[model samples]
Target: MDVLSYLATPFTDPLMLVAVALGTLAGVYVGAIPGLTGTMAVSLLVSLTFGWSTNVALAAMIGVYIGAVFGGSRSAILLNIPGAPAAVATGFDGYPLAQKGKAAQALGITTTMSCVGGIFGVLCLAFLTPLVSKISLNFSPVDYFLLGVMGLMMIGALGGGSMVKGLMGACVGVLLGRVGMDNMSGVVRFTFGSTSLMAGVPSVVAMIGLYGFSEALMQLKSRDFTVVKQDVKRIVPQFKEVVKHFWLTLRCSTIGMVVGALPGAGGTVAALLAYDHARRTTKNPEVPFGEGAIEGLVAPESSNNAAVGGAFIPMLTLGVPGDAITAIIMSALIVHGMQPGPLLMQNSKDLFYIVVSLCLIANILLLPFGLTGIRLFAKFVEIPKGRLFPIIVILAVTGAYVTNNLTIHIGWMLLFGFLGYLLKKFKYPASPLVLGIVLGNMLETNMRNGLVAFKGVGGFIGSIFTRPITFILFLVLFYFAVSRMRWWKAMMSKIKGFFKGLFTKKKA
Candidate 1:
């Protein structure tokens, strides 16, 4: 089939249009609800669409995948709870913005940026699939280790009051992450003779407790429950606002697509990396990062959605699933008798274009679906804090329980919730802790692998200098270090003062 035929496949078929629209709508709600991830939704749809035509089935799945990824930011913005792991960074500033009565603005900005990011990813998938795949091949274990270290270094950015407190929280998180059996060795490290502990603490459960449950606990202390009334008129962002952040959007989208194309690194990792990049690179924001900066909202929303497109590059070009959702989608394709390897494009070029076209349609449809539900969804924030807190508590508990269907997980959730409460009470930042949990395994596993490959600590250090990419990453680490140092700031200030004096003398 030609390009026109490939593009028209979804738009021309009545069933395909309905499937895409309905699937996108359902995906938004699925993503807004905790524990109902896009992967789960796609998995269920696979069985339902088993007998359907390949084009129709793919259209629905693509719609859901796009909608669900965008939907996650809604809850993260309106509430402290991140519906999905990818939205965790969104919550850092989104919740703060909501508390200040700009929930509508945050939602609008996130929606617009998410659409932009999704489009960028699709464009990359359509035009640069091979080049992206080649770049993805360069990430060895050492590279991943450096990436995780880079993520961990965000402690300085996220640390609210004191760097020491943030480091402490992150250290605790790393210790918590080490609770399970060693991935390389069979011996358990911190199970303490408990069967449930052997599997380790689930990061999702900890996230719900740290963010959702703890926020509820904090609300319980306050008697006044006045809800912030959202301004319905300003629910959609203006064109100028989108243009102002255009460059940041592009940069974050690139980060999202690149990270997403890497096997095993999904939207969660992509979003975090993008958020850190924004925090580091932005010169001056209207507000501090943790205090509702638009940059924070723009970066994660764009990157995570862009990752949806990046994820397809490997699956279509290399037969490698970029992430879990793509893995499920790949399974659905295989069920329909389509192989997703390098030969996939050569044999079924139309299928490749069809997938790309579906993603485009889904992302376009996302704006209408995501924006229209704001009034109704924003009402949740208007409910009395007492009532809302209980509902949030129920959702948090249910989300934790659903993770493994084990009561022990609930215990862990409550324990972490209380710990989170204590940390918040003491003004310690919780984000770095969550970051530690998320990147802990990646950091540990890769460091060990790098050590083994290079024959020890000294060789591992030397090996980084030998590789170009690793060496570049080392330079980035140095920049981060310099950026955070007081001496660097003082030196820059002196230089600026010297320039000011010289300019004044010249003018006089």
Candidate 2:
């Protein structure tokens, strides 16, 4: 069949249309609940759909994937709890926006931006798959290491008020991340002889503890819970507001797509990087970040959804899984007797187009499904603190414990909850600590691999200059470091003053 026919399949077939819609609706609810991830839902569907026609199975799975990714931000906005790992950065600003009585607005913005990013990614998948896959392939260990370091540098921006305190929080996170056994040397680093510690602290546990449980504990101090009245009429954003953030949405979507294409570096990494990018690049946000910056909500939401589309490129064209969920999808394709490598397009070109068509349909459907219950979802923010805190604590503990089915994980959650509370009490930012935990292993693993590849520290450093991409990344890193320094800021100020004086003289 031709491309037009393939595209029309999902729209024309009644069963296919119903399947996609139902899958998307299921995905949204699954993703909105903490601990019930899209991966789990997709995996379960793979088994149930094993006997179905290829078109029907693919449509359902893609719909769920798209919806679940967008759904994660729902809980992040309503509660401080991230519904999925990718939504962790979303909670940073989303919850604060809820506090300001803009929960509905935040949800609306997220839905709109997510659709834009998803469509952008699908376009890239359709038109630029080969180029993007090639670029994804060229990312060396050194490049990844530099990327992690770049993410770490965002601690300065996320520090809120004190860079020193941010750095300290990051150090603590790094230490906690080191609790797992060493993957390279087979030596247990900080397990301290506990079998549970040998496996390391789960980041999800830490996330729920730090953000959800800690927030609950903090709220316990207050007896009154002021219900913020949400303006349902304002749920859908104005056209002017969309136009204002057009460039930011585009930029973050690009970041999401690129980051998503790299193997194993899924939406979580993409969202974090995009969040930092927005933080550093946006000249003036409408509100301060970590408080309720709309830019903050836009960047991560768009990027993570864009990553979903980017993730499919490598899987369809090269037989490589872009992320864990894509891996499952690829496996399902194999079980259906379709091979997924370079030959996939030659043999099963229709399948490729079908997947693309399903993704497009699903993303478009996401709007109505996502926006329908905004007022109902926003009501979660209005519950009394005395009543809500206990419920949050229960959810937090349950979410943390189910991660590994270990009580020790629950202990870790409580410990981190207390630590997060203390950090907040002392005016330290919790975000950088989470960032450190998320990137610490990636940073360490790549740095070690780069050292091994180059034979020594000096050689590893020199190798970055020899490669085109690595060299460019190094230059970007250098600029990032210098631009944040006091000297550079002062020099730029002087240059601006000199230009102003020159203009004044001309006027005189």
Candidate 3:
């Protein structure tokens, strides 16, 4: 009964409804523009909404979150430019569909499946958040340190093509994250005796620079400004096809949710995994995997959308973010004088329900609004980089200054923006760096606290073997670390070949 009332509040509040609607409407267009991402949009929102009421602020942010994620697919299908990383897989078949004069059909199908996946994720968050929260209540500082370790390992190993490069970027981020006053010792760190450094490097500024400004810089390098025009007809997909893919959509959504729950592996990985699942399971694909298979579209579209819900669970319950956007959201909550974790669940159940309700409403709105602006959005995606990048630069500079109204922060933004551009040029993954920065403080504080509690370094090290939870986390961390080693993968490959040869000999 209590949950029912909490869920009903969003619908009853006219202001909340309008905020969500407007945010989602804006998000759809923003996300369609290449180089703009949900994380970037949310970061900008945090600055603008810092002075607003909590519920209204959250409603607007949540609407943008849902809309931006879905909006990425528009550019992917029409221009072969994935608006965000999560839509990379979508472009594989999406662009092909556009070339085949079925862009409208592809857009409709993706919209439907994205909604299906998103709702499925929300349901999982509702049911699993409490369960995860209960388990997190038992976590000690040692366990948290190990969790941070695992997060870094996963981000490095799975975030990019080169694990070494990913880990290097993450290490740099962790070091940068340490540039503030240490809470435990009351000693300044990495400040170079500058008073301004006492407040440390603002994560908000880093986000604005790295993702927002650097992204604009990266996009400006491409000289091809050609836009392919598509004649979009049939904004609705065939009912029979949707019915036929229903089970596959559910399965992919499940994949997405599970991946999204794990820190560092978000929608991109979920979509890839789901796309691979579809290829392996479909006994007969109407078209081969790469060249416009409708199944390809269904798997990635559904899974990535569903991953959004899964991404929020860890953030709301455990205070660990599932991805960069969630990390920004976590920062927003912190700025609003709220902590997200087990305590958040116990003290602010209403807020939790409100977020869930907003997600549901945004997804419902996604279908109609996403479907309605087909032709206009298709043109919107083609807005030339020449005109677009200047506005983005202006927004980035403004967003940085808004963080604390400090001119120095804008310089911080430019510095990080240049560094981010270098990372992009070298193909280094930016996500691991962001994750490293976010987790560094948590990892250091917990390790120090745990050492003091255990009475010494030896006992702190021993705690991993003594505590059941800590021991399990240690093992998981170990596995993630070892799996990234080239030697281990090679050894596993050899072992597999030996077994296969043995089986063949026996059959002969």
Whole-model Cα lDDT of every candidate shown, in order = 0.88, 0.87, 0.78
lDDT of 2 by residue, 417-458 (tens): 999999899888887888888888888899999999889899
lDDT of 1 by residue, 219-281 (tens): 889698887876666888989889999999999999999888988777888898899899878
lDDT-wise, the better of 2 and 3 is 2
Compared to the true structure, candidate 1 yields what TM-score? Answer: 0.95
TM-score for each model: 0.95, 0.95, 0.63
Per-prediction tally of clashes = 0, 0, 0
Error of 1 at 243 (Å): 1.1
By TM-score, the candidates rank as: 2, 1, 3
| TM-score attained by model 2 | 0.95
Candidate 3 lDDT, tens digit per residue, 112-223? Answer: 9998888898888888876644554566878767766655554543355677887888888889988989878999999999988888887656755776677678867877
Point out the worst 10-residue segment of candidate 1 by lDDT.
224-233
- Top candidate (lDDT): 1
